[model samples]
Target: MSDIATAAGGFRYRLWRGLDPLPSGLPTGFAALDALLPSAGWPAGSVIEVITPAWGIGELRLFLPLMQRLSQQDQYAVWIAPPYTPYAPALTQAGVSVAGVVIVQPPQPQQTLWSMERLLRTGACGLAMAWPRQPTPRTTRRLQLAAQSGHSLGVLFRRQHAGPCRHTLPVALSLRLDAAENGLAIEVLKARGGGQLPAVTLVWP
Candidate 1:
């Protein structure tokens, strides 16, 4: 069940099975950033944390490539509790399969986490993304375990806060995104088998 991704000029990337030490991951649609990751892309079956100072800073753009690939797959790409309604036309223009994209908004914040865990643990979805407010370490750990169980990718987007402590979270990867002069700057805060690396700048996807 290898997930295959083909890039421009016939380049291909292969996703490996989930393992304890991590394995080759799915392409993130950006070659420069992929070169910086140990798995060469987003680690499959693991949770990733994206921390930003504010919204609309190209945070969603970073995952657009990955979303496009996952959405078109046999499984669904579920988005839980998005900040705003996703614009279909814009997503279509980005090469995403609208039919494969599903949105779920829970009335209560706690329910959002529960929904994300269920979807990720079902093995029926390729990816599950959420924007949870005040996620405790226990909550993240649960999400991580669920992703591992289903071999799905889980993304948690959080706003930058004062005195932020990323060490408390059990996510497999933690990245800090900031707006660069020409494009977006992705700083690798924490990664499996690696420490903080230099930021990689690339045009918005």
Candidate 2:
């Protein structure tokens, strides 16, 4: 007879199921974008990968609303090794809480990733945004785990290459941003539970 046992005797062992319900997501401030996401918003407690052909394509604009919302929270919105200094007046005008924002500039690339991981695991960081020039698969995986442990939202901005990456790291959401006519176009490469979605364009009002 097989060694495997059945539950006929009311066995205490429980069968493994899927992940439990995720924490409710924070609104993306765009109805269309929110609707497209699996959680109907930026999935909380996970890493979000944003790939772009280059800067100045409304990458920061895409998250302005999210920053404003996070500003109202008790946790800090931290920026790690940003390419350019965040314009305070612009962020303020966007309704972001300047007081709740924190910027960190690490001296070296290695330190940048290290700082990002530390901030995300602090539990007091509401959002940890980083622009990692060359993040390995293992590095991304560690960041994802840190975000989950601290329940923080981590955003990784990567420069778009000529072709798809050889190895795509698993993330809660992966988005590619492109400049559209008077707006930004978003292509969802992968969304947990939501799968891939058609590109959505958001016209600037």
Candidate 3:
């Protein structure tokens, strides 16, 4: 005998449900983009892996809105081994409360991962971002678990072509980004409906 578990009301799919009712996503500050996402925004308490060809590239802009909101809520926003110095003026322009933001530049990539895990697992921070050199399958899984354990948001940034391994990682979401003249071109490699989603264009205001 099997229990019938379903989500999205009528649509039924054999999927493992989480311990709690699915939490709502944080608004991504873009209406069109949010509508495209299954969760309507960034999935909370899960690891989101983003692959980009280069650093900057408006990638920080993509999350700045969310970070601003998190800061407004008085939640800790931590950055691990950021590729560039996070300018205070830029953060202020983005509306992120500079006070609530913490940047940790560990001497080693391993230490960066360790720091992210602790912040996520302890719920000490509402959001954590890390730039990993090359995360192993075991490492990715550990980060995922740590975020889910405390209902925190974890974002792992990596360079493009650093993938192929992305398909094997246990992240809740995976997005490949290319810098566009005006914004970003995102390919949803993996998301709610499973692998194989079309690309979308995101323009910043």
Candidate 4:
């Protein structure tokens, strides 16, 4: 059987019936933020869009925990064009195994997205994260399809002020991050199964 078929046949996939069910596991980056996320974990086989006006709006921090958690599950976490050379020490501090993290440098944002999609389609990595300079609705839809086909998690980080695309993404949720005095604030702009909700603030350790 193909890798995709194997993933779909796995117990986790069966439990959720192909689509990811809520209340999954998260990384160990932040305690407070994990509490606010649905199912206290990142949703597999879904696309999560993270937007921020500034680079240090705790966006990386938000994903650290999720990465750490996924790493512990013996799954690889792939990062494309990460803004900063992920401090392996910092990742270790966050309880993530640096060994399981794969960093890829793509020539352009579009290439990065394409690489991410290919990885998601392989069902190899547990999670894939990318920072795309420009993301269209159509591109996101393709990513969603890839995630579902491979039963993997894909996250897209985009600029905060960018306008919505003409098409709609197949993402389960679209979140915007804002820096707060205490930590980071998350605004759920759009969601699929559930409607939008007020912005939720979370503190980072």
Candidate 5:
């Protein structure tokens, strides 16, 4: 299927499908979630949309292991305008380097997106994340393409629907997260190969 995202300039795109086998990824620590992900870990050099109701809904927990691993490997992990202050003790306990983390809070939303795109495009950060209100198809495409141009993983955490749009996001992975009894429930709305995948319910590591 094909779609068009209209902005000042329109972006036309098709569903993502890679002919090569999915690449290996950093382990998610949550075995169940890793098993369902395109790679054994999160997809590298791609934008992953994570939709959640709130900050503490196991979102950070879901990616902590990956972040820590990247930091240990000397890659910077960045958070652009995160919803809440990251507790240093908690992150340290998780084995993440506090020094390797960069938090940028742009005074304006437009600057925030711009900063995110630049960081992801440069691939200087191992991961770059942002929490923003709904973005236009054009904006999402820009960030998605920027991530593809670099090796960093770009993540957007939203509070709205994560379904397919008429002007679909060029994201390689999309997930909807909700608090579950044991931990969190993740619905894989899209994966590397471009299709609806299964839901993964797991406990916090």
Candidate 6:
């Protein structure tokens, strides 16, 4: 039966059998940031870490547009251990479909990662966001494999003490947020692509 499906339409049809088509790379609402990212967009089938010392550092700001874009395309977005209750008004204003948002709260850090991995591997979700205290190497490896297998986007929100991950995969970026006179200052501490490394100051209007 499976062979017949593949023979009829090739691997593309087989890969998407019984599932919605996978989303393309993230659509950065901001053109400049989009260009900086490899593939000119967020990496699919990979784990991306968003680290911050505290909440309200505009970390959500960086993620909101991406989430909104994904939801706009009728894809689902999952949030694990979100710091606060998301304001529905704000999300709606940003063009995200509040209906498609799924929030999962896991009691333990390990459980959070486990849930995220499971969801990402299900191929039923387009994106999964988790705030894990300190992820272990074993957990990260598992999550990495799940993301690749499902071709899902995983964003791991880490605290300051999460420390340096020793994973073999190279760190794509390390961003630190600070308060600037204008607004929030985002410093690209480390990135794979070389450049002047400008600090982006974003003032929410």
Candidate-wise lDDT, in order:
0.84, 0.83, 0.81, 0.73, 0.78, 0.70
Best by TM-score: 2
lDDT of 5: 0.78
The candidate, 4 or 5, that scores higher on TM-score is 5
* Residue range 1-205, candidate 4, lDDT tens digits: 2465357653323343343455344443555544445444566677888778888777887777667777778888998888878788888988999888999999766698889889988777888989877777788889988987887889988776666553445677788888898788888777543344567778655
Per-residue lDDT value at 35 in model 3 = 63
Q: Roughly what TM-score does model 2 have, to 2 decimal places?
A: 0.87
Using lDDT as the measure, name the better of candidate 4 and candidate 5: 5
- Put down candidate 2 lDDT per residue, 27-117, tens digits, no spaces: 9889889767767788888899999999888999888888888887756899999999899999889989789899998888888878898
TM-score sort, best first: 2, 1, 3, 5, 4, 6
- Candidate 5 residue lDDT tens string, 1-205: 3222223222212213445555446677787886667575688877888878777778888888888888889989989988788888999998999998999988877787788899998857889998865566788888878887887888888875445553456677888889999699889888875355679788764
Clashes of 4: 6
lDDT of 4: 0.73
What's the TM-score of every candidate structure?
0.86, 0.87, 0.86, 0.78, 0.83, 0.74
Per-residue lDDT for 71-168 in model 1, tens only?
Answer: 67757889999999989999999988888899999999889999999999998888898999878889889999999999999999999988845446
Q: Name the regions of candidate 4 deviating beyond 4 angstroms.
A: 1-40, 162-168
lDDT string for model 3 (1-205, tens) is 1235223443322244443344468788987777667667888988998888998787888898889998989999999999889899988987889999999999977798889999999766899999988787788899989998988999999887753544457787898889887989988878754435568899877
Over 4 Å off in model 5, which ranges?
Answer: 1-24, 161-168
Query: Which 10 residues in a row give candidate 2 its minimum summed lDDT?
Result: 8-17
Sort every candidate by lDDT, greatest first. 1, 2, 3, 5, 4, 6
